[model samples]
Target: MVNYALGNNVITQIGLLVHDIEKTSRAYADFFGVDKPQWFWTDEAEKAKTEHRGKPTEARAKLAFFNMGSLQLELIEPDRNPSTWRESLDSNGEGFHHIAFVIEGMKEKISLLEAGGMPLLQKGEYTGGRYAYMDTFKDLKLLIELLEKDR
Candidate 1:
């Protein structure tokens, strides 16, 4: 499993990027035989960008959040815009985007990672907790989040 945490907990989440939102999410839902994930549109996440990246910009995203047992999965379908998701889709075809780890002390963790050479791609607070992104591999991405309970 992809490790997004630093000696934290077991792998708890997976993020997938797709060119077609409905098709991919439908496949996963059918495969898992689970209810559809809570959907979030670009407008809802507009404030998320500002909180993390500090800008009044929005990208069209069709996001679905689902659960497999205790593990959470996020499927992303990018809309036409200049966003990290869009950038990733442009560079690489639809596939695994990032592995997210639930952590504590986001700023401290981010500082250490940044000092160690990992760059912070974006961060935002939504739904309850704060999340940060970093490039752990040349191709794949890493996302770190402090859960609501952690904070």
Candidate 2:
């Protein structure tokens, strides 16, 4: 059954974690016939690493955004960091890592999920908007997110 917390009529993004950014992006672009994606580093994520985890190192993440009809596909490749994506790549090779769904009441959802089971792995907002990395990997091996889009 699909999780209703993700809401209806919308699933903003599907995040694909890859080991090779360029190759993966190109493959998706070719297969789906979509525009080239924009690559970016998660600046807010890096800062949080310093403050929260004390691992103040900059890890490269190449992001490519594309519109497949209506749903957005976000491809992410972590540059050799031993984070979740990296570990997944190292252990399982390049494949689907997470699916990020845009939602309202993110904070409340976080609490509700925590109360139920999924604990937060990481949570923060960037120039775009608020996002939370809640750990639901134990069951699904995927990171579940609640995103509040930034205007």
Candidate 3:
């Protein structure tokens, strides 16, 4: 078996880009017979320390999460700012964005992926952890996200 560079390959989350998060989330909740999950904006750039294409950016998005067994579905509505989310939405017209895996060794994992041709596209810190989006679409057919929660 091939050893994965980022450790466990279990996908914990699937993200979708949407134009209207409220409408999309409500539709999903109704379709699944579940209550609409609350949506919130990502932390400000000051707190999140967001970077896109290696430069600091103030880009942010409205996000809502739905728990589906061991995996999560995330809806993202990006603001009119430069970010991986916005770029994908504008280019692809709102659809599946990325699959995420919880990981450790953020720097090492990023380096490995980059060296392997999956260059880092964006990165940012959240409340308890950090996340990086890798440009893996060309090889994997979807962007890959690495999430590392503080231990």
Query: Best-fitting candidate, measured by lDDT?
Result: 3
Candidate 2 C-alpha lDDT tens digits along 92-151: 877777777778787778777777677776565566677776788877677776788765
Q: Which stretches of candidate 1 lie over 4 Å from their true place?
A: 1-7, 42-46, 51-56, 138-151
RMSD of each: 4.1, 3.6, 1.4
Task: Give the residue spans of candidate 2 off by over 4 A.
Answer: 1-9, 44-60, 138-141
**93-147 per-residue lDDT for model 1 (tens digits):** 8887777777777777777776666667666556566666675565343444433
- Relative to the true structure, how large is the alpha-carbon lDDT of every model? 0.67, 0.68, 0.94
For residue 88, give model 1's deviation from the true position in Å: 0.8
- What TM-score fits each model? 0.77, 0.76, 0.97
Off by over 4 Å in 3: 1-4
For lDDT, candidate 1 versus 3, the one ahead is 3
